[model samples]
Target: MNLVTPPEHPFAQFVRILGKGKRGARNLSREEARDAMGMLLDGKVEESQLGAFLMLLRHKEESAEEMAGFTEAVRARLQTPAIAVDLDWPSYAGKKRHLPWFLLAAKALANSGVRILLHGGGAHTAGRLYSEQLLETLDIRLCRDWQQVEKALDQQQLAFIPLGDWMPPLQHMIDLRNILGLRSPIHSLARILNPLNARCGLQSIFHPGYQAVHREASQLLGDTAVVIKGEGGEIEINPDASSHLYGTANGVNWDEEWPALAAMRHVKPASLIPEHLLACWRGEASDAYGQLAIISTMALALRGLGEPRDTAINRAEALWASRHQVART
Candidate 1:
């Protein structure tokens, strides 16, 4: 019997580099990570190799530079419309405890004529409601492609591009959640992807530690971004708890604290009917918690777009108050 050994794969090399014994294993350099991620996104890596690379990276906890590299590959491959987008909003984390209050915030921003490109994917884990699943109930534009994103922006000024529709390979990595039994590095990288090279970005994470990670990577990527530990981990503020906000604008870095909006702690709604999101938007429902969360989230987006704190907060409140009463078209 004659058996030729299979050629060593570049991805396998990458896996070995990261998975080498404790002392031997080290994080990949920016360039190395960029190459690895580029290969993964292009479907050049074998499935088994892909799984190993993702798990290894996740276990090591990616560095800011590594995150920057992975995000670089993702941003390059995105199909963006020609339209000018003022904001980049990524909403990967699904709503586990609250309805998506940030969707209303995006809507209010759009009503005020701020063109936003909101992108995300979620519900890879059970018992969660992602933006894609609930945004439709409000009739918010859920674009299937860059063309639809363009049209939605032209018509509505706010649009969402679900990860699966915009970047299937990345979504495939995310979809591996069930098999992997843990989140992969793609979650953080996907949230940092400013696909259209927008002027500003808004990000939220469940962990407080990633604030610096996201801010540094955004700085390296040469854009302004605001990050916080949002409610239910979905870029929506927690009215019941103060938020630690971190970001950078221009050449300056920022670390600030935003006080909670609701006076008292809130209990998760007994049941979440997606319709409540729309009702709140339409002025038919007025839960103080939902209202404050929406306004605070909008203010964060405005701050990312270069508004001063007081101005952003004030403008967000005004925008929320004056939003259209009619349902989304």
Candidate 2:
């Protein structure tokens, strides 16, 4: 008997049945994961079936092999641009609470000659505008075409691609999350997919629970990446001085000495986060904290900015300090 055979109906039919709770909650084999992802990415899966598939996968939780297989299917569908930069940052959902700092990080990296590609979609909620909106606030427009992105990278060392253009199917999956009012497996997958040929990426996750999922996903990637626990899901290092875990292609590194809030002698309360400071950072007005956050995250990135840890940190501090003079001017 041939053990390997396609399902009797369309793959979407099988997906709909599997998603409808017909199949007991169980881990998907590697092949099953690949086929499901392929159908979703190709737009062959119906909206209802899509929701079911996503929810089921979330409950079952993706294993490393399953994630790798699913990502491989996603990678196959994405039109990755050939850029020379080694690092790309893919920001995830939710950024309403804290000041958006990834823009500053991207700008600083661009200013320092690191080719950075940033990508994300618009606000799923009324209160939360996304990184793309924040970038627009800074006069940075999203580049929809691969050639245009390459041109921007060659000229300014930075480019932003909107999800609707860079990966529509993935965006479609993300849209479903909003409708369901629950995050799906695509949320995790989106954070890990690097759409550039570059071999290194910087990814940030907001929830601690997802850290292991990111780690497992990163192993499927051919390039080196650092997974950071970020503020409001943006990749900027936490300004509250929380311990951050940095997972690279080789292994994981933890910052043990990160200052805790209670230990700090002088710290601003979350209620006291200055609006003028945020506006200035957002370019709606001029303020200092935004500038400080930008400088600090840039320094952090520079410390591990593709060099030996010590050298990167030393250089990052020096570079950060140098910006203070400009802030005065």
Candidate 3:
């Protein structure tokens, strides 16, 4: 007796399109990628197909078109409000070696009237200190939805939203790190989401070659963004070493080198202390490395927002110096 072949699952086509033999496989077109991501976000894809699709894409590193397409699908479903956001800061990569000095930098900028939205996936990886956990200590509000986001941004010029709250599907994928034994493209896609369409998007990559990918992807998405190899992959500029900034603005792509803020490399702190961030901001602590990290990271964001190099650095320094006064007012 002969058996009839069953019809293929609709989502299986996407998995096949990506996982076909080396000779047959190819990157998906922007339209295909957008459709695939839409299905994933809508929970239409099955578990087996979902794993295969993501891992196949991961094996062959996602392209700018893929990233841009994925970002489009995500933004389409996002319920972003009309609130004007100056900076889109995604902090998915939790810090391990250093306290999240960038948080302090963001607080200073927010205090000085720069409306910023910081979103992150909860700490999926072990032994890292994520932004969401430390927000209370820093006195920044952790918002759960657009309503809270709008209120926080209006009240304090800053808001921190976790991925699980805004986009549960992406956060689910991030949490699958242990099961998959490798990170999916969701990590990179999350960084470029910029759900609020902020004028300036800040992205960081731990791996090399992704900077260019992020730059091209941001250009494709028509985003003014800066891509950096942040310290511990958290967008915090390391004071001990020179760093390169790859970015796009007004549809133009550019790169620049920033000198080390410290004369010599400083050893990593013995431990990451959460309270130190607030203490530094309150002018109760003096940490040369931490202070320089905050100013340099702020300057990078300011430059991404169209400030001149020297002027951005000067402005960041001034912002840090007067953070207490900004808070009081």
Per-candidate TM equals 0.95, 0.80, 0.97
The order of the candidates by lDDT, greatest first, is 3, 1, 2
Q: What is the lDDT of every predicted structure here?
A: 0.85, 0.64, 0.91
lDDT of 1 by residue, 59-83 (tens): 8888899998888887777666577
Which 10 consecutive positions of candidate 3 have the poorest summed lDDT?
Answer: 320-329
Candidate with more favorable, higher TM-score: 1 or 2: 1
- Candidates 2 and 3 compared: the better one by lDDT is 3
Clashing pairs in 1: none
Worst 10 residues of 2 by lDDT: 320-329
Q: Which candidate number has the best TM-score? A: 3
Ranking by TM-score: 3, 1, 2
Clashes of 2: 3
TM-score of candidate 3 to 2 decimals? 0.97
lDDT of 2 by residue, 190-296 (tens): 77777785556676777666765676566655546666677667777655566455555555443323343323323433642334434554456643444555655
In the range 220-301, model 3's lDDT, one tens digit per residue, is 9999999999999888999899899998989999999999989888888999889888888788888889999999999998
Each model's Cα RMSD: 2.2, 5.5, 1.4
Give me the overall lDDT of model 1: 0.85
Best by lDDT: 3
Instruction: Mark the regions of model 2 whose C-alpha exceeds 4 Å error after superposition.
Output: 1-8, 12-24, 250-292, 308-310, 321-329
Between the candidate structures 1 and 2, which one is better when assessed by lDDT? 1
